[model samples]
Target chain A: MTLVDTLQTSFKAVLSYRLRSLLIILAMALGVAAVVMLTALGDGARNYVINQFSSIGTNLLVVLPGRAETSGSFLGAVLGQTPRDLTLKDAQLIGRLPQVRRYAPLNVGEAELSAANRLRAVTVLGSNANLIPIRHMKLAQGSFMAQGAGSNAQIVLGAKIAKEFFPRTQAVGQRIRLGDSRFLVSGVLMSQGETMGFNTDEIVIIPIDYAQTMFNTTSLFRILIEAKSHSEIEPAKQAVLAAMKQSHDGEEDITVITQDAILSTFDRILQALTMAVAGIAAISLIVAGILVMNVMLVAVSQRTAEIGLLKAIGATSADIRRLFFAEAVLLSMAGAILGFLLGQCGSLMLRLAFPQLPAWPPAWATITGIMVALTTGVLASILPASKAAKLDAVNALGKK
Target chain B: MIRLTAITRTFHMGEQAVYALNDINLQIASGEYVSIMGPSGSGKSTLLNILGLLDKPDSGCYELDEKRVTDLSETEQAQIRREKIGFVFQSFHLVPRLTAAENIELPLTLSGIPSEQRQIRVNEALQAFELKQRAQHRPAELSGGQRQRVAIARATIMQPSVILADEPTGNLDHQIGAEVMTLLENLHHRGTTLIVVTHDRELGARAHRQIGMRDGKILTDHTDDAG
Candidate 1:
């Protein structure tokens, strides 16, 4: 028979058993939709992280005290068991490197600040004047601390802290007591939102030396570095590591990581998550295939007399096989297309709910979902179609 | 023309071999109207199946239109069946999902005939069977006589040279059965070979040749030119 004739005959057969065909189609559609929606979520997470990282300055490097080797062991690190701590002298040496454009020595602590008889506990950040350029910070009033003024009792208030502490007066040039130390506010920062899970608008910044004196520690928290250019990142990282080893008595007990490395690691992990979810969703497609096989087998037995009649009317065994195969393919194709449309709608809903996330399904996942559904459907029907073809016409026709 | 010689078909029922057709010999010329009448288990139906190529004999030499067809391949035999033979069944095995017109067009459709030509042949068959008004009705919607007429139209749509009817009126009343028999007879009068297998003696008497079978063997063969 012609291709059109074969499809038409199978279509009629599928239409005849409405409820059976619908159940199978619904199963197939659910499988494909699951793949699409899950993959979209995974990809959106990856995109969200990348966007978060991109907001910070590029060509940046972080220097944390103690080594974290690539062998996956913590070993004298992360728990502060290292023999030497990263000091301000180490930061001074790294900041002087020719490949380094800027550096910020960061020391984080928490303290109570009271002003005009209003007291509140707040996060305190200790960094240098160059921190404004390196961290992409802005000011709404006054100016940042002067360069080379590490010993001055000056502070910059985050936008939210400024609003809360000095609601009726200018924040800059105002005196506030912080952990038994009095300080003059140098500036009120612009209202920048959260970045890398930390809200910059909630912290108060002071010079690194006074912060060390107030918190009573000589060790630095970590150093943020910006290289002179994109190509200078690797050279600057090596220079900083070499200088740290020299200052710490010839011991390389520091971990130096670039921003690109962290971003790529997150990217790899999220992409693998997408694939894993797609694989789990593909199992449903296989189950749907088994359902198709089961229903087709029942149909073959039910239509034995029809098969016999076809044979008696001169249809060859190959013709019988083609008709059944065509039926399976048509059902799967219809289900796949319907599922793709449904998945698109689901993803659109997700995007509307979480406007920040880019929750669109990738092309590869969509194509593979449809192709796998079709392949499984055809494979499942092989046994039933062959059984129908092998029927003995005389016996199938029954006794007269 | 059709011929069969030394044909044997054995059936094994729980290790005991019984002959469904034993050493049968028969011949019928082209355009001949013949009938085989016998009681149940007499193997008359088995003979008709062998002649229609639906069952293979244990041993046989058969020829149709001067070609040896006993050992033809399955595909080749199907082609021969499509081009040279037609079958009308006792229960009127029309596909219930298809309309009457589609049922009659089945043979042509299976033969890869294009839609325009298939439609023409189906329309002609509907007209000839007097089923023009019931063309769009499904088998469940058609009456007994109308269903049988649709089946007969489907059987002859390929314009085969030979027609085989096995108790074609078994499921109908006397009036509908007579009408269906008359339809088959009308095809036979148009120079098409007709073979009917039945247990009704009155129906068997209408054929030009009569063969009575018993216990898988032919008991009597008679030819009457006047009938």
Candidate 2:
């Protein structure tokens, strides 16, 4: 028979047998949709993490007090034979290096602050004025404490803290009681949500020296260093390490980490996770393929008399094969189109539900889902089509 | 012209060979109306199947219109069947999904006839069979007589030289059976060879030539030249 004639006959057969055709189509559609939706979720998570990391300042180097080494004895660390503390003097030495553009010494503590009888416990941050630019923070009002403004009773309140402490009046010029002392609010930080892990809208910032005296400590928590350029990140890390080693009795006890390293580590992990989820979704496609085979087999048996009639009317074996094969391909093509539309709708809903995540299916996954579905459908049709083609006309006609 | 020489067909039933056709020799000319009648297990159906090219004889020399069809390959046989033979079955084997007009156009479509030509031929067949009103009806919606008429129209749409009818009216009532038989006889009058296999004596007697089959052999052959 002609190709058009074959396809028309197959289409009619599929349409007449509505329930069987719908079941197969549903199975195939679910397979394709799962692949698309799962990959979108995985890829969205990866993008969200990368977006969060890129939001922080680039070309950043961090110096932690202790060396992160597997060879270090746990017993030594437990017995307090730890590495020397990273001090503000070390931060100063690192800040002067040519590779270093700016540095912020961070010391974190928790305390209660009161203003006009309103008291609430809050996290306190100790850092220099450079912390604003190094961490990419913005100020809403007034100015931050300068570098030489050491031991002054001056503080910066976060947007949320400022609102809670001095709701009616301007917070930048007001005085607030912190710990056992009182300090003037030098600035109000902008409402920048969260960065890394800290909520910029909730914390309070003060000069590092004043925070040290108030908390009764001489050591620094961690030091954040900004490189002059992208190419200077490695040099900046090395310079900070060397400066800390010289200040701590010629020992390289501090661990230095670059932002690029941590960002790539997270990227690799999330990409792998996406691939793994895609693989899992592919298994459902295989199950759908098997379902197609089963339904086609049943169809062959169900249409035995029709096949016999066709053969008796001069349809060759190849014509019979083509008819059934066309039916399978048509079903799969329809299912794939339906599934693509369903996946797009699903992704749209996801985007609406979680606006921060970019949950669009990758082009490769879309193409692969369709291609694999077609291939599986055609492969699954082989046995049933051949069985119909090889049917004995005499016997099939004999059947009721 | 048609010729058959020493045709034999065997069926294996639990390692026992039961001959369905045994050294059967028969000949039929084009434009002849003939009927083969027999009781159950009389091999009349097997004879019709061989004549229709739906079954192959184990040892035979059969020729149709001077062509040695017995030795032809399956594809070549199919080509001959498409161009020269038509079949009407007892059940009126219409595809339930297709309309009456589409069923009549099946052979034309199979042979790659264009749509415009197919439409013309199908319309003519529907009109000729008096099924113009039921042209759009599926088989399930058509009555037994109308279904048989549709099947006859489908069989003759290709203008085949030979029409094989196996119990064509077995599923119809007595009045409808007479009507269907008249339909087949009308095609025979138009010079298409009509071969009917049935166990009904009255139906077999209606043909100009009658052959009775039993035990895989022909028991009697009678021809009335008066018609």
Candidate 3:
């Protein structure tokens, strides 16, 4: 038969047997939509993490004490191997590099800040004046600490800390006792919501020397360095390592982590995760393909008499095969078009419900969803189509 | 023209070989109307199937229109069937999903006839069969007489030289059966070769010649005047 005639015949069959056709189409569509939506979630999580890291400031480096390759510099003290202390002097030498913009030396401790009998336990962070620019922090009221370093009593309170410490009074120009020392309020930091697992608004800030005497420690918690430009992060890391080795009697005791390295590591892990979930969702598509095979086989058997009649009316076996293939393509094409719409709608609902997620269907996932469904549909059709083509006319007609 | 030489077809009915057509030699000229009548399992249908190229012989040869068609490939046989032979079944064999007009155009469509030409020919067939008013009706909606007429139209739409009817009236009432027979005979009168297989003596007697079968062999042949 002419290709157009064959196509028309197959379409008419599909329309006439609406229920069976709809079952196959629905199976395929759900499979495709699942792939799209699941991948959107996985990739969305990756993007969310990347954006969080990006907000911590670009061209950044995190320097930790001791050989982090041998110690989880995080849990080294608990593990009985003490990491060498990193001091504010090392932070100064690292800042001298032409590629380095500034470095924030951090030391964390707990303190009770009392303003008129209002005592709240708060985490106190100690850093230099450059901490404000290096960490990309802003002040809502007053200025940050004056640059000359000593055991100065100037302190900045986080927005939440200031409000909780002095409920009815102006927080700037207020005095709060830190251990045995009284400090004057220097600035009230703008409220920064939780970022990279740290809540800036919930903490108190003091100069590095004052925190050292209060906590009785010469070691720093971490040194956050911002490179002069994006391309200088690697050079800045090298300069810090060189300076640490030269100053510490040639001991290579620190681990430097660049923002690019950390970001790429996260990117790789999340990319793999997205692919794994997509693969899992694709299993449903295969099940749908098998369903197509099963339904098509049943259809061929049910239409044996029709096949026989076509043969009797001079239809070649090729014609019969083509007609069946046309039916399969028609079914899958309809399913693909419908699935695209369903997947898009599903993704839209997801984004609406989770505004922070940045959920979107990736282009590759969408293309693969439809293409894989089409490929599976064609593969599934081969067996039933061949069976129909090979049917003997007289036997198919149920005649002896 | 059709020729068969010592054509033999066999079937195994649980270990015993039964011949459906045994050593049968027959020749039919183009445009001749013939009827093959036999009791059940007498191999009348098998013989008709062999003549129509729908079945193959176990040990014999078949030549149609002076071509050695017995050993032709399945595709070749289908082409010959499309261009030269037509079939009308007792059950009508109309595709239930298709309307009367589509059913009538089936063979032409299979032969790759263009849509414009297919449309014209189908319209003519609808009018000729007095089914124009019912052209859009599916097989379920058509009367027995109308379904049979639609099948006849489909069978002849390719303009085949031979039309094979296997009890074309067997499923109809007497009046409707007579009406179908008249249609087949009218086509026969127009010079298309007609072969009808039926056990009804009345139907068999209406053909120009009759062949009787029993025990897988032709027992009698005679010239019969058209009723």
Candidate 4:
């Protein structure tokens, strides 16, 4: 028969058993949609993590005061114990390195800020003027603190703190009492939204030493460092470690983490996650394949008389097999196309619902969905098509 | 023309071997009208199936138009079936999903005939069977007589050399059955060889040559009476 004739017959057969064929198509479509949507989510998460990290700084490195060499005993804490406090001298020493462009010593604590009779508890970030460049932050008004030793009483207000504390008045020139010390506000930061789970817009920034005096602590929480260029990141890390060791009495008690290292670690984890999600989704597809096989078997048995009639009208066994196979391929193709459309729409909806996630389905995911669906269909139909082909014309015709 | 010699077919009923066709030998000339009549246990269907190449005889040398077809491959047999033979079943095995015209065009479709030619032939067959208005009706929508007419139209659409009909009018009323019989006879008069298998003696008697079968053997042959 012509290709058109075979297609027509197969289409007619599928339409005749509408419910059965519809069930198979629905199963296949859902299987494919699951594969696509799950992969999109996984890939989106991976991309979002990398994007969050990249947004922090260029060629950046973080110095935390701790030696994680005894990491074996640390159960849930990523921040290891600090053998000795990281002093401002250590940060100053790191800043002297040729590979290091800038560094900001940090001291974080919580305190109540009272201004205009409105007092609210706020997280206090203690850093110098270099903190703006190192943390990639901007200001909506007023200048950032002048770069100097850690002795200034000038402070900056994050956008949320500015709007909440001094709503009717200019917050930049106001003096706010922070834990008994009064400080002049030098800047009001722009509204930078959430990043890496922290909202920088809701904090107050002050000089490192004043913060240390208020909190009565000497250890720096973290030191943010930027390498002169992308190629200098490793050298800057080694330099910073050496400087910290020198300042801390020749003891290696600090962990220096490069942005590349963190990025690669997250990249590897999310790659595996994407593959694992796809594999899990593929299990559903296999189940759908088995459903296809079961339905085809039932169809073959149900259409015994039709098979006999075709054979009686001069259809060879090969013809019968081709007809059945054609029907299966058609169903799978239609289902796969529908599933791809549905999956894309689902991915779009997910992105719309959570705008932070990059939920666009990748090309490989789309191709895999279609190819796997078609392959499953062909594999599932083989046994039933062969059975139909082997049926004896005389006996098949005798079936009521 | 068809010829069969020493055709034997056996079936295992539990542990007993029953000979469905025992050493049956027969010959039919071109354009001849013949009937095979028997009781239920007789070998009427067995002989008809073997003659139609729907069954394989345990031992036989069957020839059609001087071609040795008994040992032909399954595909070759199907090709012969497609090109040179037609079948009409008692239950009127018209594919219910297809319209009457499509059902009549089934053999031509299987043979890969172009749609234009197939459409012309189907239209002609529908007209010849006086089923023009019912051409688009499915088998379930047509009466017994109309369905049988469609089946005959399908059988003759390929213009096959021989038509094998098994109790073609068995399910119809007397009036409808007579109409169906007249349609088959009309094809016979057009020089297409017709072989009817029936339990109805009246249907069997209408054929020019009659063969009576019993106990898997031909008990009598009435070739001398030419209707």
Candidate with best lDDT: 1
Which lDDT tens digits does candidate 1 get at residues A196-258?
988889899999988899899999999999999989988988998888878888889999989
**Tens-digit lDDT track of model 1 for B14-92:** 9999998899999999999999999999999999998898989999898999998988999988888888899999999
Shares of reference contacts reproduced by the candidates, in order, are 0.73, 0.71, 0.67, 0.58
Q: Candidate 1: where are CA atoms >4 Å away?
A: A53-57, A68-83, A114-117, A129-133, A136-155, A166-196, A213-218, A228-235
Per-model lDDT: 0.90, 0.89, 0.89, 0.89
Give candidate 3 regions above 4 Å deviation. A69-83, A140-154, A162-187, A229-231, B225-227
| DockQ-based CAPRI category assigned to the predicted complex of candidate 4 | medium
Give each prediction's root-mean-square deviation over alpha carbons.
3.0, 2.8, 2.9, 3.0
Give per-residue CA lDDT, model 3, range B1-227, as digits (tens). 99999999999999999999989988888899899999999999999888888889998989999999999999999998888999999998888888999889888888898999999999998989899999999999988999999999999888889999999999999999999999999899999999999999999988888999987788888875552
Candidate 1's chain A scores what TM-score? 0.86
Could you give the CAPRI-style class of model 1? medium
How do the residues A13-131 of candidate 3 rate in per-residue lDDT, one tens digit apiece? Answer: 88988999999999999999999998999889999999988888878898888664544445554453544689888888888878888888999999887877877788999988878
Greater DockQ among 1 and 2 belongs to 1
Candidate 2 lDDT over residue span A1-400, tens digit each = 8898889889998999999889899888988898889889888999899888877776888887777666645333344455577788888898899999999999999889998889998899999898988888899998897556655788999999999988889998899988887899999999999866879899999889878987999998889989999999997888778777778888767889899899899999999998899889888888888888889999999889988988898888899999999999999888887787887789889999999899988888888888888889999999999999999999988876
Clashing pairs in 3: none
Task: DockQ for candidate 2, please give it.
Answer: 0.73
> Would you estimate the TM-scores of all the predictions?
0.91, 0.91, 0.92, 0.92
